[model samples]
Target: MPEVQRIVFAGTPDFAARPLQQLLDAGVRPVAVYTQPDRPAGRGRQASASPVKQTAVAAGLPVFQPPHFRDQTSLDELQALQPDLMIVVAYGLLLPTAVLTTPRLGCINVHASLLPRWRGAAPIQRALEAGDTESGVTLMQMDAGLDTGPMIAERRLPLPATMTGGELHDALAELGAQLLLETLPDIEQKLAAARPQPDTGVTYAHKLSKQEGQLDWQQSAQALANRVRAFNPWPVCWFEWQGKPVRVWSAQADSAEATRPGTVRRSDERLYIATGDGWLELLQVQPAGKKAMPVADWLRGSGQALQSGEVLT
Candidate 1:
């Protein structure tokens, strides 16, 4: 395989940042790094740099934050770098043909899925939500279509029955970085003979929205439990209680006698709520504007006088 020279890196989040760090660790320096513009984040809504930008800045590499690259000016700037290869991961923008063809060896993407499956924005969360048994990363040669690229290499990991989206995301990020390091040496050859993605088993992982977190008690307990895991640490699974929103941080489901869904049933200190088919026990929760606490803690403190018959919305 020929040595890659003057590579351009494009990415935005922590997933992308890890691989760039790994490349740096391996003494591979990028000619330029491209990341999204700083955006407001946290409770204060302060403008913050993306993880990729942070890594690039810390490494003293030049960074670009073009809102889009379709314009000729942006295209010109990218061309000036004279990249041999472009590595993209969660870059959050589509690369036009001009930009794609600019690199000598072409643009290669480190996608967070075994392509032809979970081929869009929220692959990790979608896999967990669907109760998939396995998950993996795919290194591919970029094409115009969404994740519709010829794959070069892939690495897999088994999905635990109760894995959370956050857990899977972190694990996959590291796994992707490791895979990138191992695959880089053979990248040129792999690209020359990249395999086309199969049309079967192709699924789109739609981007998650805050509205999806609103829990629907009519859904089966197992389904809700899966969603609870998939939406954690984001728009956390929630339901209204006493006209206020209550976020469920952790929970488990149990098969039980049929009852009105959303009815609260107490057994000692445990808080179990009836679902369409079973009971979902709330392990941890956050009442609107309050810090998350164990259900037992909330029951003993703020909910000491509350009885079992109330229904959650």
Candidate 2:
């Protein structure tokens, strides 16, 4: 395999940033870095650079932020780079065919799923929500269709029954970086042997929405528990309590006597909520405008006392 020259990296978030850093550490600096334009973020809503842009700036690499490639000038700017290879990871923008073919070796992507499955946005969270036995990263040769590319290489990690979305995300990010470094040495050979994805198991993981976090007590306890774990550290799963939304950070499903779904039940100091199939034990929670705390702590704090049979609609 010939050595890759003039690699151009395109990514935006921390997941993408890790692999970029690893590449630099391995003495393979890209000619240029492409990231999404700074966008308003945080409670202050200030325009902030993406994690990838920050890494590039700190390393003194030239950075480019184009709103999109719809304009001819954007395409022209990239064409000028004459990249031998383009490594795209979570860049959050669709690349036109012109951009895809601009690189001599064509573009490749680091996607956070097994591929042929969970082929769209929000793969990490979707995998957790679906309770898949395993999840992994796939490096693919990019195509115009969404995440529909021939596979170059892949790395898998088993999903623990208790793993939350945040935990799985961190694990996959590191795994992806390691996979990229391993593949770079043999990338040319791997690309030549790339295999097309199977069509029978295709599944799309739609982007998450805040509304999806609203806990539905009518669902089985195991399903609700999965939802809570998947949505944590983002749109945390919540349910109405005393005219306010109380976010559940951690929970577990337990077998129990049947009761009306959404009914609050207390056993000694522990807190449990009735679900369609069983009981969901609330391990950690955050009251509105309050820091997350254990259910025991929340029970002892200054808040309205939860009645034994009070419904948490």
Candidate 3:
């Protein structure tokens, strides 16, 4: 009989892939992996591989891409595996109470944020959007409520003011993987205890909305920069240039004095837009479905000239 833990891992995205890979590298081959079914993607609407699915496949492990967890037959299959414990990381599906209790050691979760703080879908982005000073991964015991579980471990990370959502996502992913690796021995020994989430403060990191990417120049420059960082690599921050939409990849709050919010202020070969608080300098941008280019390159190709007093909205 194999002495390694009989584990079932559940997750779907890149954030989940890190821990899955770590477990495999540590020679803790999961008994099975359950991820979200592949979904139609791209212009052709082809079924695309999920990050977790790809990692599971690369590791030569059994992969289950189920659409739902409610079917008793599917539940029975998981139970038959007799998993010692289930490790779930952003699996996207809610594990029914029955399945949660089925595992011999119950389930452990690797949440991206310190629990009871930023608990929900988009913790990393939410932290950047809120201008949070720090964020971390919380290892928790699964419960019925959304991330309303007792924490087994936690590791904090300081938030950088200039970091984009994508960067923070990568950072948390690595941190989460390490935290999970650290918590495993205790989990096997049944020495881990579930501590209730604090009741004093609770905030939900709601899922990202596509509309949030639509840049509103009326907002403050700092606020707009936050939006640019928060929505990156998803619903990218964008606004119209000569009636054409351009996505802004990177930018900084312009340190100059402001006149009217949204007015274009060109400073030292850079494009700046006045906002309620200050000005913002456009660093990287894509012109209406074209490749994202540095702000300087976009300047050379434009027909209409960017000038002060022209509102960017």
* Candidate of highest TM-score: 2
TM-score rank, highest first?
A: 2, 1, 3
RMSD of each: 1.3, 1.1, 2.1
RMSD score of candidate 2 (Å): 1.1
- Against the reference, the lDDT scores of all candidates come to 0.90, 0.91, 0.86
Clashes of each: 0, 0, 1
Per-residue alpha-carbon lDDT of candidate 1 for residues 178-282, written as tens digits (9 for 90 to 100): 988998887888888899999899999999999999999888888888889888877689988767888998888888874899888885589988899898988
Cα lDDT of model 3 by residue, 1-313, tens digit: 2333689999999999998999899988998999999999899999998999999999899999878879988898899999988999999998899989988888989998987998999998888888888999999889899999888889999988898899999999999999888878667543355678899779999998887888887788888898888878877888877788889999888767888878886644578888888888889999886899888888767724877678866
The prediction achieving the highest lDDT against the true structure is 2
Task: For residue 159, give model 1's deviation from the true position in Å.
Answer: 1.1
User: RMSD (Cα, Å) of candidate 1?
Assistant: 1.3
TM per prediction: 0.96, 0.97, 0.94
Candidate 3: list runs displaced more than 4 Å.
1-4, 188-192
Residues 215-281 of candidate 2: C-alpha lDDT, one tens digit per residue: 8889989999998998878778998777898899999999877599988888546888899999999
Sliding window of 10 residues with minimal summed lDDT for model 3 = 185-194
